[model samples]
Target: MLRVLAVDDEKPLLEELLYLLRSDDRVLSAEGACDATGALRRITRALESGPDGADAIDVVFLDIHMAGLTGLDVARLLAGFAHPPLVVFVTAHEGFAVQAFDLKAVDYVLKPVRPERLAEAVRRASDHLGRSAAQRPPGAAGPPGPPAVPLAGPARHRPAPDTGAAPAAGSAAAAAADRAQDLIAVELGGVTRFVAIADIAYVEAQGDYARLHTDAASHLVRIPLSTLEERWAPRGFVRIHRRHLVALRRIDELRIDAGTTSVRIGAAELQVSRRHARQLRDLLMRQATG
Candidate 1:
């Protein structure tokens, strides 16, 4: 059973999240907070007093925009902890979607939340916790360390295997790779459209849909930015703002103006949130130098 803590300033949205979470049998416990300060207090309390004095929080569902301290601020505070909960940013604003992922958040959920979307986010959190637990060193109480790098060694040479088996293995591997790279399909005007992963310049979250910007044109799809971010992030997509996820390779220019930084992709200019400016600049610099 996964332990979850949800924080949002909006009472209605908070209640909705609580209701959706409670319906899931996999959830062991759920706590809700209406503001950042209160949420932080609750989280600290949970850490201090574990479930049955054994288990602590496994995941946090956070809202990016809140009164006093924003969800991003809360995440930064938690980052200082030795064992921070896995964060999933839940917000109605798409502008922060990219910025959320840039924080290394496990997932993002957009409101008004759908049951299917909430279920997917919960599943991802559970999987992340399971993998983290499996990777921990013997007797370790918290998250695991960085992944180990395999040591260099001479190539393990072996005699050519049977032709039949070799071709079958290669075919299976290629098929799996293709499946992993399959494009996301979106329906518009009663016609289904597919956006190739490589062709997407960026995705911007509007009120209810995300706009897919490509070299040729733009298309609107009725899917939340949070869901798209979780699905495409692993495929070379990076969030630069709450509502924007840009393809790192498609970035034509990075500029600073009046103390604010922005990225130019194709013809569209997108701002880099203040919280994400430093990290995005650093990443761009590293790529340029590399």
Candidate 2:
């Protein structure tokens, strides 16, 4: 079970986050902090009072746009904590995805949260915690340390590595590549594989996961469509409907039939939601010019 802290300056949003997290079967406790100060204080108190030095917070669902200190600011402070909780930024803005990922956030969820989407974030956080536990040395002296910082910015394409020589750890290029990976990891037949974002024709939401459609196959990943929309929008993926996101480059044709807007990507014809149709067309026009 996971113990979580929900932080947001807005009272209603904080309440919503808490409610949603608490409703999950995986969550043991869900608490809210109206600001960064309160969150830090709670974390300090929890750490100080926990039995045998265990962390009280397993994950933090934070809001990016806050009054006193933004979620990013809070995250930076968490970097200094001895046992920093997994941070999941729940924000309306999509532009912050790069920075959030750079900060090593477990996941970035969009505003007007969906139950399935929120649940997916929780799963990601759980996976993160499990990985952390597996990597930690047995009976370590102090609390588990903060997460490692992720490299900033999109990576430029580089040639494949040679089997004979391995690149040194923390190489600038390697870090950049890690940060800028256009590929998303997906589990296929009990094996992990990387699916290139460019090759993805479209993405469809599937409860707590997403179906990544490519030319030859589709892989179901434990990431929500909203999360992918925020992360990949800057990379030519655009939301065409509530349940679907299409890659601008893979969209071979757009159709408006009987006042209904739709797009074609590799024989898959997906209807664009009324609200997102105009935006999709505008994006298509922009792509046409660029």
Q: lDDT winner among the candidates?
A: 2
TM-score for each of the candidates: 0.48, 0.48
Each model's lDDT comes to 0.75, 0.77
Give the runs in model 1 whose Cα sits over 4 Å from its true position.
50-55, 142-290
Per residue, candidate 2 scores C-alpha lDDT tens digits across 35-72 of: 66567666665555542345567788999876433678
TM-score of 2: 0.48
- Show pairs that collide, candidate 1: 94-242, 94-243, 95-242, 95-243, 96-242, 96-243, 97-242, 98-239
* Global CA lDDT computed for model 2: 0.77
lDDT of 1 by residue, 53-152 (tens): 4436778999987644468866766666667788999988888877788777998888888999999999999898889878978776754222211111
Please list the residue runs of candidate 2 whose C-alpha ends up more than 4 Å from where it truly belongs after superposition.
Answer: 50-55, 144-290
